[model samples]
Target: MHPDVAVDILKKAETSLVSYRDTGFADAQTSAKEICEEMNVEAALKQKRLRTTKRQFSYEAPDEPITDALKKMEFSFFNVVVDMAIESLRERTGMMSDVAKKFSVLISFSSELEKQAKDLCNTLTSGDHSDLNYDELIVEMQSFPKQWPKQNMTKLDLVFLEEKGLKEIYPNMWVALRIAVTTPVSVVSAERSFSKL
Candidate 1:
């Protein structure tokens, strides 16, 4: 999947999880209530503090309505789950950004993205690795975009270059695009972007 596509997926996932979770909890609560009613018993809920400090006393909670108890359950369980999912998505968003930073060079060069290209080069060359030439990459980045038949293209797909026959003339871009294309990717935003591709 494209980094942008993957990022787009993660971007909206938190909202979707939040939006849908409430309905899911409501449905589950209703189902549980039905089960409890079929058993012919009153719904019951009580609470007690689990711990007490040396100078502290635990408080016993009075009986509460089932609805209140369920709400508490949602806050303790479902809310935590949703929060964890959101946090995981946030981490993945950062990862997708890093992937995009490395692959930004694969897109048509822009004055703004030049820094990313340089950074990518520095990263690839760091710690006794020198597979890429910074100067050559810079030259190629500036000149390579002109080869495109359309200068205004959005979301460049490197696979299309298969027919362009310009790899030798723009080896650095070829390498960068190859890396980007080969990078592992995922999900709906990715699904949509690849469909567009």
Candidate 2:
């Protein structure tokens, strides 16, 4: 793998975590340059070990060029780092993250996110006995940004403060958030528990 590709993967892995989002995660140029420094340390160690050894060089085979050895080491490091980055991205974006990305409408909404919200609604309503109404949900979702009142509305309790709750106000969103987003995990697991393995 190319060092640039490895650095890009590392950047993706680093930014995938919410904690590292604001840290810049060490730029690609710096990370690529780090390989040479690591190679220097590795070379010094090899030289020190050779000095203490009693083995002599063989005439049958030629010694590999230092540049070739460095290139090999650099490529090896790139492959390993890229693999590690892929694993980290997979591990971090778990089932819950998938659900969150799908139902992010609960947290915030914008013109850009409308398509995602519509798709989420469509996917939710595609199944049998789905509680969401795609057409209504799409219309409501389009207008939600205007009525959002955007007061860090992560919790649903505040919206449910009234006697009738959000259902009476934004019926589609209420169903989308409450029924689809909240029930998918437990509902699927519960249904599967009774099925044959």
- What is the lDDT, from 0 to 100, of the residue 157 in candidate 1? 56
Per-residue lDDT of model 1, residues 1-197, tens digit only: 57877787878986788776768787777777798899986656566445433444458755444456567888889889878887888888887888776766566565666687778877667588765777788887676556653543433455565667877877776776676665666534655455322
Quality of model 2 by C-alpha lDDT: 0.53
Steric clashes per prediction: 0, 0
Query: What stretches of model 1 exceed 4 Å from their correct place?
Result: 21-23, 31-68, 145-156, 186-197
RMSD of each: 6.6, 11.8
- lDDT, model 1, position 107: 64
TM-score of 2: 0.41
Clashes of 1: 0
What RMSD does model 2 have?
A: 11.8
| lDDT of candidates 1 onward, in order | 0.69, 0.53
lDDT of 2 by residue, 1-197 (tens): 22223344545655664343322233443664687687764322232222334557877765544454334544566445655755665553454455656666655665556677666766676456566666676677666546554664553442452445546657767766554323323224456465221
Instruction: Identify the candidate with maximal TM-score.
Output: 1
Residue pairs that clash (backbone atoms under 3 angstroms), model 2: none
